[model samples]
Target: MRRILVTGARGQLGSQLLRCAEDKGLQAAGVGSAELDITDRDAVDRWVEPDAVVINCAAYTAVDGAESDEAAARAVNEIGARNLAAACSRAGAGLIQVSTDYVFAGDRAGDAAVPYEADDPTGPRSVYGRTKLAGERAVHAELPSAQIVRTAWVYTGTAGGSSGAGADFVATMLRLERERDTVRVVDDQMGAPTYSVDLAAGLLELACTGGRGVTTLHATNAGSATRFDLARAVFAEVGADPERVQPCSSAEFAKPAPRPAYSVLSPRSWEAAGLTPLRPWWEALADALARLG
Candidate 1:
């Protein structure tokens, strides 16, 4: 049996990975941020042992906040990735890194949402994306065998009894639904809402392939969703009127971090790995709501 070291054990994906490890009979340990400061190279060097695969899930996930804290985000996302890769290389272990879909520029001029491929041009619109892309590069630099899996709009079934619907897409929707009677969500951006649990299962297969060099894989759910569509879905799950959710544009919800108007990652790598396609976002959302109930 191979030992697996999972960084950011308490994070969304890390938690899912932990559950999968138990279900799939894999030997794995997910460590929290308190135990492993991924930004510290020497600390990482001390922590990593020989012959253990490293899957880095630790990252600065504050998308809007990263705009003002690029330095800190890069330190953790880019520099820390390099640190992990170096440690893994020294120990002769493989590395699996998690990335994001924010790396795209969100050009949706055509009717079809651009299917971002592994070789597509990376035009990041936010600090978070830039740092994540740098981290992907860093992993390849130190350990050519590193695998990067990029996912987007990750959510779980049970967020401590809270509704997953609109939980992420429309934080304001949930607030307004509770406080007022109506709310508006941006309808411009489109992205796949990835179920962390499903994505985690796929990662294990990719890493165990033991393939050489860095491979960027997009492992999101099958369908894409607009913020408006996602909000309405949440309201439906809660037995609230969908009409209460209104449609708006990015201009109305101007945030510091520029959201990609279209950030849809394909599942070709998942197919290549012979893993079944992830369930539809709506299906996952329903399961998530059931878990909440």
Candidate 2:
């Protein structure tokens, strides 16, 4: 049996990954941050045993907050990653880490023009981005057979559950449409909003294909979406008023973290890995919203 150990098991992607592994007949156990403190190098040492593929899903996701708390962010994103890499190395297990698009600086031109490839020059604008990039670098350097999967705008199966990610954009929009007469979302920023369920399934599929080691790959929904368009889709999916969600520029609500204006990562890696494309955002959104209700 392929025993898979998923960290951040309580997280959005981690939760979905556990479920996917179960479906594929893999013995998967997810230990959340509460169960294992990855930043504590000894904790990681004790947690990882001699067998099983390790997937690191836990991350400090606050983009703006990371700007102010750089040290804490590094401790988690960078140091934590290395700890896991070292543990995986010692255990002789494959490492699968989930990363983000923030590693890229937002200076790329046009909305849908720049599709960040795996080998692109990483110019992270935010502290969170830099730390995550550092973590990726550390993982690759330490654990040779680790697979780093970078994704964006993830929505999980439990996105509407008591957990955090479930209460994210889709749930928020659904709530806003019900209570508020109108909701304004940023239109300038663009990304390939991925579904965590889809991403999790895809990750396992990639791993099951018989490859091991550290290779960077991107996985997300097929199409690009502005935050406004995503909000609109959510409203529509839940049978809410699409007009209630209005389009606004990111400049209107400036955030501390400089969000990438456009981060439409290419799905070329999926094809390269001989895996099928992930589900489109529109289709996944409808399924997710319907499941929510």
Candidate 3:
């Protein structure tokens, strides 16, 4: 069995990947930024092994913060990815780079808001998005055969979710359901609410099977929803009244970095690559809540 080496091991996806790999009895190891700074080319070279398939989950994912810290974001998202790709190239190892749906402009509406295909033209509008797109380009440039998997709205049902915020959207909704009589959520933005555990499983399968003909693919829970829909679902799942959640517009809570209005990634490319399609977003959310309790 090929060894699995996960970067950003302490992260939601990385940690879940590690657990899944161990459960499957795969030879796997993980390294966080503290253990292996991917931005340091020499350190990455020293850390990467020839027989391992490296899953790069390390990233500067502070979307709002990236507006001011573009250099830091680029260091991790672009240069750091380049370093990993170069090391993998030299070591004759496989690389799977994690990406985001923020790479697209995502301004389409109504009938035009179809899911984004892997080969669609990119139009990133935020520093985080731009830097991540650069990382994708860098990875492809350094290692043409490396696989890039893009996902969106990823969350762990755990206490502290992946967003680096105090609590993730789901956790926050749970809190709000308890503290307030009503809650407001943005309904204009749409994307799949991907469960980190599900994504990790798919990635592990990809790591084990090696690349198909395609280099880039999209992975997320099957269905798409707006934040309002998701928050209401969370409330309903926890036996709270879904009607307590109200729909609002993005203008109500503006952030430094712009969020994609439509981020639903198409699974056509992923399924065409012979990978199993992820379950529906609602199903995944139910399972996530069950696991949380």
Candidate 4:
């Protein structure tokens, strides 16, 4: 039985991975920032053991916040990644580093929207994106055998039934539906919504199906949607009037960091590795909403 250690155990994806790992009877242990700080090289070195597989879910995911605090973001997303990669290499263990689709500049013409591939050229526009890209480069430099999985629009439905800033879009929409007469969402930004539970399963599959080599793969629920679409779906699911959910431009909801006009990540790499792709976004959304109920 291979031992597994998950960092960022309290995060959306990390928490789901820990839960599924235990439910499926896999040999796994999880630690949050409190127990193990990847930014601390000596601590990571002390925590890692030989023959273990480290699933690194720890990351600084504040997109807008990173605009003002690039240094802090880099500490966790880049330097921290370097520490983890170096430690994993020394321990002679396998590593799976979770990454984000923000690595892409996502400024393509709306009509030219395309799913990003694992080996595609990257040009991150935001500090958060740049730092995460640095993390990927760091992992590759130190531990070329590490698996880097990039995902986007991730929501665990833990944050008041939505996903975003620890609260997901679903949760936010559900809350808004009850509080307001109408919900305004951005329709221009396009991407796939990934349920943490599904992503956790995919990571496990990647770990177990070991023909290991350093690989970059994209994983997310199939299909694409805009925030407007997602919000409308949420309204429909909750028996509210979908018409109350209206579409707006990104400028209407401008933030500190720029979001990719398109964040759809290609699933080709995941499928090429002989792993199963997650179900359609709408289908997964239905299941997730059911669970939240």
List the candidates' TM-scores in order. 0.91, 0.94, 0.98, 0.96
Sliding window of 10 residues with minimal summed lDDT for model 2: 157-166
Question: Mind sharing the TM-score for model 1?
Answer: 0.91
Q: Give candidate 1's whole-model lDDT.
A: 0.80
| TM-score of candidate 3 versus the correct structure, residues matched by position | 0.98
Off by over 4 Å in 1: 157-167, 170-176, 209-214
Best lDDT among the predictions, by candidate number:
3
Please give, for residues 182-221, the per-residue lDDT of candidate 4 as tens digits: 8889999989998888999989888877524539999999
List the candidates ranked by TM-score, beginning with the highest: 3, 4, 2, 1
lDDT of 2 by residue, 1-293 (tens): 55778898887778878888988887788899899888999999888877677889989987889989999899889999999999889887778888999999866774536788887888988899999999999998998678888899887534354356447676677667878899999988889888877888888876666343328888999898999999988877777778888889888998898898888898876668777798788998888777776
Model 3 over residues 49-103: C-alpha lDDT tens digits?
Answer: 9978999999999899999999999999999999999999999999999999999
Per-residue error (Å), model 1, residue 90: 0.8
**How well does candidate 4 score on lDDT at residue 239?**
86
**123-186: candidate 1 lDDT, tens digit per residue:** 8989999999999999999987778888888876443213222234433445566676888888
User: Model 1: which ten-residue window has the lowest total lDDT?
Assistant: 159-168
- Deviation from native of the Cα of residue 144 in model 3, angstroms: 0.3
What local lDDT does model 2 show for residue 200? 84
